[model samples]
Target: MQDIAVGGSTVSRTDILGQVEAVGVGSFWATDEEGRLVYLSAKALDALGGGGESLIGRPLVEIFSEVQQANGEEAQRTLGFQLRSHSRFDNMIVRVDVAGDDETGQRQTRWWRVSGKPYKDGNDRFCGYRGSSIDITAEYGRQLEAAQHSQFDPLTGLANRRRMGSRLSAMLTACKGAGRSCALVMLDLDRFKQVNDTLGHPAGDELLKQVADRLKTVIKDRGEIGRLGGDEFQIILPDIDDRGDLTGLAGRIIQMISQPYSINGKRAIVGTSVGVAIAPYDGVESDELNAAADLALYAAKGSGRGLCRFYTADLRESAELDSRIEENLRDALVKGEMRMNYQPLVSPHDHTVHAFEALMRWEPEDGRPVSPAKFIPIAEQTDLIVQLGGWALRQACEDAVQWPTQLRVAVNVSAKQFMNADFPKVVAAALAGSGLEPNRLDLEITESVFVGDVEAVDKTFAALKRLGVRLVMDDFGTGYSSLGYLNRAPFDKIKIDQSFVHGCTEGGTTNPAIISAIVALAKALGMETVAEGVEAMDELALVTERGADLIQGYIYSRPLTHDAIMERSGTENFVFPPSGPPRYRAGRMNFFRKIGVIHEDHYYKAMLRNLSRTGAWIEGLAGVPEGTDLILDLGGGQLAVSKVVRAAEAAQGLKFETALIGDGNDGLMTRHRVSPYALATAGMPLAALPAGSYPLAEQMSASRSPRKFFEVEV
Candidate 1:
């Protein structure tokens, strides 16, 4: 058994055999052209537990027979046929069951797959098969469980959404071939959110599982039932004969779901609203039918729960309206029609301009202004909100560049926009494009955005914060109100919705109380509150008294254009004279000596605002506090006052008279302006009047026709 050198190894045949036997896996031999095992390596023997020496010179059939009954001569014949039919087999697998030792408490034997490949001798002749037996029972079990889970619900072990999808696909094909109608029913458990919110999530989960079980029982042998996800489930009814069948099935489902569910042995009642759409009647296509079913589901929910709704053309029309709005909104952005309107946000206390709230407007060429309520939902539905919101942000930033650097601009962002994958990029683009400081921009998002995927939103919000931008949760306490969001997401400000603000306003004093509550809540959260829809003076005062940080609405101004805002803010310093009927005066009033005696009726109540003599201002006016020179008529004559004594309401002493700086005798004589009484000396004496300490008009007193004062001055 001495061997010649092969591949730089000079050893005896016995040494080569010993080396092959030492391999960790196993080696084996077979002699017949059919490749039956004639020998087994030591490792192979150990692998089979003390059978190696005994198995030498044995046919493979005899060896495998003890391992598995399925591995007899018939199996060998099948393997021979396969080897002859095909080329060299790789990873050829087979499974055999073997019993475990008694100590392991084995009842049923487990199965494994054995992989083998034909081995050959140096003469290129077939020798025997050599391979390893892998215990793949666990892996095979996992694969089976995974397959089952793919088709079945994890909670109730009923079929799941994936299985429903496959089944529906097949059903549609079958229906198409037979020209039959099938019904797809989708159900959503109503009041599910309240249950989840008031009770615990674990309780909700148990209820859902119980609901699923009830649905399974109700739909048994009728059709397939599946848990679509969350509190949603689906049913597929094939071969629907009539509308009544579907209604009956839906009725049964509602009845079953309406019953009390025992969650942790606690009785809880829940109901479902079912939506049904039939193939060939509602829609010919599967997806269309499913969409119709969803529309019907929405209608069912809209009509109130514990009922069902069938898809109708009207629902499609409403759905189409949504579609058209969404499509048009997307086009509006492309067409350069989507614009931002700047509604001045005023300080409620002083009515001083604080900032502008950038409101979105879609002004079509042919129609009136499209309300945000009309188009905003469309943007949300079509996800055009992300684009429109970005455009608004850019426009606001650009407009802010023209404003006082201290003035911030706020742009609202919908949940759809805020949740966009590229929201950060969109904001960065806007800021870069407008060259506006990020700190001057506020992004308002509703509370809905913070409800789900909070981690993603948190990270995005943090990124926005790093850019020196402020984030506000708008319409707080409206939908899905979660205090947990404040604890999680960083909110710099909060907007009390117009509904709440308007309600408070109508409630008057009660309104202030509500505003106070909201303000207090905001302050506790370290947030500022901006009262929306502050459309009346009283409302403004009320919100101011309640400590609202900001106020915005029509009471101040409607949304203005960029040019209008620039004009209002820039040219606002130049003062204008009053426009009213001029009085006939008999005086060339020296401009410096002329104190414009403005009567109470001559000035607007807005102009009769709070002030002191030393350039103090009306507290509630929307513009600059200081007054400039203006012409005014005191009913006796018109004079140019260098400044106004725009006195406070309390300062209008007696008849709300203002002081005149000079004597009227020479002042009136320069022009054709006359007064009823003449001035005198001693103590400011009255001429041609009755002898009383106060001046009085005499009966049948001498009168003179006065010339017009403007012509006389000219």
Candidate 2:
């Protein structure tokens, strides 16, 4: 061994090499032209848990199985590629499997950064390469943590907005290139702000974590879910284009998320509204699709939250309609455009009116009646509901005071109004100011009031109870129906939701069973039960037979105006005899509008008197025979194929070939209509379909026969 002088001391070559190896800053390694390891430092071999002699003939690339770029994406240049090309590489990060011993004795993964330079013989032929390697496992882990922190929500561990945006963009691009479809669902949590305000943000954070877990369970392997900041979430489903399947999934999500959650030992309930958009059909790009889904979500929330909506071309109009309604509703209270209509609830035992439900109706200044279904939800979304609800309470109380009889007046209260701290005081003021007996006033509330803190809900109930007023559970068995609510809240009556009454009398419907059980449960609880929406004699008989204590529907009378109720109240006793259809059938909507009917080569104009899912009655068709096939054009390119089932004097009942589906609004519509694409193919301009008439006239060349029936003015 030779001695080397350094600074102020002399050291042997072996001692200097030993000092360099002990520091363990890095290790030096060499490979043959075939990329086989020829030399490895003893220190490196020790770190790898092997002797340098044993790894002498192993392939270098085989030791490092995978390589990744600095940004965490898979590297374009693999270790094998670089080694086979005999090219020099610098600072390449690679993952290697190392032998290790633990209780389970499994192989452990380790990361390394290796830099190498290729060497060649004097003949300019590649011979071997040398490289220096450093262990980077800890630093790689820290980088991974930082990357995840940037990409995921800290509270829920779900992907954040940036990551979701990137993922959606990439997925949409790939789906467009492959000519496939992707479904994106955007959801916003309902009543989540109440939770945050009531239980504090920590509880809200816990609720969010639980929600994320439920989402993962529900969407397992089928899609990816991301929390897009706050209470909004986005889900991406690839290759799923079926609306039916998407609807089912969205429903599951809504139902699952709406179920009761326990936060910090207190029960909290919230709901979610989902809007879905399909790629290429709804939009081709990420931003466009996201906006479409957001608009659909807005529509869902506007159509009363806790629901799901699939995006359609008509949603833009619906969104605009909602904006208009919301704007109008803000001024409706001051303008006196809102009124109360009373619907009598009659006892099934004696058919005498037991009470009247005060339903709110909005007669806008434009002379059009806006359905409560449309504007009530809008009011609830803001402070307008508290004002509207207070007005209704006072009006109902005053109206009941004028009645000769002590008939109870049931005033509906929204969840938002009920959650207000001064709600009970408002009720007291209504009763005191009207000089009405509190016992004659019933406050109808839904299950949503139970969503807040138990102490708060209980306090409200106690305060209401102190006022000597009757509390009724309205819309029972509709949403979040729990016996626990029945056990906790002090309710005097249970009003069956109209949905249960719709098909209860029909064959093969489990609604009868459900109604029977509800009636039984209400009876056992000593609460009065009223079955709502009894439109026919059969439905009435079924509910009466099922032991419902009272009934309210068109079978008795539609919502009556104040004058009508006052006129009836003048009598000693009032009883509304059940007057409606003899048999229970699908609901019929009356419309006196002219529609085009096609028979053979003649287009006859007829009046649509009434319509149902399966059939319709049209007048002004003089002599249409039985089994005559006809096409009824209901405008907007909706053509229904029908056959005359019954003929009469200038009128006929036609059975449709296919049943109509719901129009999202409370109307029936044909499933498929003439697409703008079809209109374009028929020589019309290529553009979106406009409202009103369908552009089918230009394509039809058949001659029209003379009108057989005189056009009767409606």
Candidate 3:
């Protein structure tokens, strides 16, 4: 052995190597041409709990595995691949498994940074590998922890936005190549700001943690969840394209997140709106998909929070429309374009108009009338609602004072408006300025007002009551219809939501039971009940039999303009006799519009006289016998299959094969229409349905034949 000078004494190379190994600074290892371990240093064997002899003939890859990163994710490079490639490796980190369990009953693990060089024989044949390793367990752990800190949220312990972006990009790329699909669901917590404002940031952080926990429980291993900053989260679901399943998952997530959370011994309630976009269908790229989902989220929030919306081309248009509305609404009040229409609430017992609910109507300077349902929510989201509410209240008060009769004017108060500190002042000012008796003004509030700060809500109620205005709980059963709200709030009346009344009179429906229960509950609480949206005689009779104290709907009269109200308010007791369909008929509309009827390879133009959920009456088509099957093209891709129930010269009453569903605006619509997909199949481009006839004449070859029924000029 060669000797070297050390500390003024000659030391051999072997002695130096021995000293290095004994001090645990490094260890030597060698593998045969087969990559099987031929030699392992005693020190390394000691670190691995004395398995050197047993591991001598084992493959080097079997003794050491790739190190796992601190995030509990496996490192990409593999020891086996490097060994098999017979390539030189420098400072490759790996994990070694020890022989026995540690005190905690977990298998002992050790990490090492290994460097190896492939060796060759004189004949240039592959021989083996000579390597050295150093214990790097502690250093590796630190690096891994640092990496985890960068990848995960410290507060929620969920993957942070950075990790999520990287994962999403990678997943989208892989799925694209494999012809698979992925879904990205974006969620925004509703009313989360209120929680932070009320309970402090610490509580908010705790709530986020609980939210993360709930997400994990709900998502399980089906998807990966990441916190995309405050109150926003993203989920990556692999291999999921079914909209039905995605919708179910989104709903579950919303419900789970909406459940009340207990933070710091106080209860906090919040809701989540979700937007979902499936890969390739919504977009092929990650960023594109994210943008689609964001648009969907915007639509979900716009339509009303606590709902989920899937990405569609129409959502962009709807979003644009909402933006236009938001911009135009700011100038509406100043421009005097806003108005109120009064809908009479009649006494069922005597058929007299007891009160009129003030409904806001907005007609822009250059546009047609906009529904209150569309713009009121936008106003509520901003400070515009305070101005709007004040205006409505004052106008209603002034109008009511001018009436000859003591008719109460009920004005709807939104949750945001009600929560305002100066709301009571606004009401008092309206009442004092108009000189209207407080008892003649009824404030209609929904259950949403009871969402936050219960004590403040109670104080508002007390203040309003002190002013002598009657309070009515509106849309009682549509929301969180807790008896708790009725118990806490001193409501003089409860308005059963129209949803429960829509099909109450239909046979085999459960709505009647629910309505009866609500009536009983209201009676027991000494609060009168009003059934809303009653549009037929049977509906009226059912509500009357259920002991509803009042009724308000088209069955009596539609909302009237201020001029109409004045004309009808000729006497102090204006009583309008009930004049609707004899029995409950699926709500009908006097459409009187031109439509096309397809019969036996011929299309005849006809006039739609009236429309109902279950049927329609058309004129201008003569010689169409009863029980004749026909397709009515209602335009814009809506086609209904009907059988003529009654036929007369130039007139036919047809019954639809399928009943229409509500159109979300209290109008009837077909459950399924001519889809853009079908249009595409018929050689049309895949795009939103354009305004015109669907199943175009050329596409429907069956309609090419000559007319069978004589067409009458409309």
TM-score of structure candidate 3: 0.74
What's the true lDDT of residue 120 in model 1?
Answer: 74
Off by over 4 Å in 2: 1-45, 48-94, 97-99, 103-107, 113-134, 587-714
Question: What TM-score, over all chains together, does every model reach?
Answer: 0.43, 0.79, 0.74
- Against the reference, the lDDT scores of all candidates come to 0.61, 0.82, 0.81
Which of the numbered candidates is closest to the native, going by highest TM-score? Answer: 2
Q: How accurate is candidate 1 locally (lDDT)?
A: 0.61
135-230 per-residue lDDT for model 2 (tens digits): 898999888778778887888988888878887898899976776778899998888888999999999889999999999989999887899988
Give the per-residue lDDT of model 3 (tens digit) for 1-714: 589887889988867777899987899899899888898877888777744466788888888787766665557876678778888888887888755635655567788899999999899888999999999889888887898888998889899988998888989899768767888999988777777876788888898899999999999999899998998999999988655567677778877876667787776677778888777667878789999999878767766666677777667787788888989999998999999899999999899888999999998889899987789767877788888998999999988898865688999997778988999999999999999999999999987676544567788999999999999999887654357678878899999999788878789989999999999999999998999999888889999998998999988888988888887667454786777776765567898678878775556778998988889999998888998999887764567899999999999999999876543233565644454335535553322234445445345444334656898876
User: Lowest-lDDT window of 10 residues in candidate 2?
Assistant: 683-692
- Model 1 residue runs over 4 Å out of place are 1-293, 296-315, 366-369, 505-514, 572-714
Tell me the TM-score of model 2.
0.79
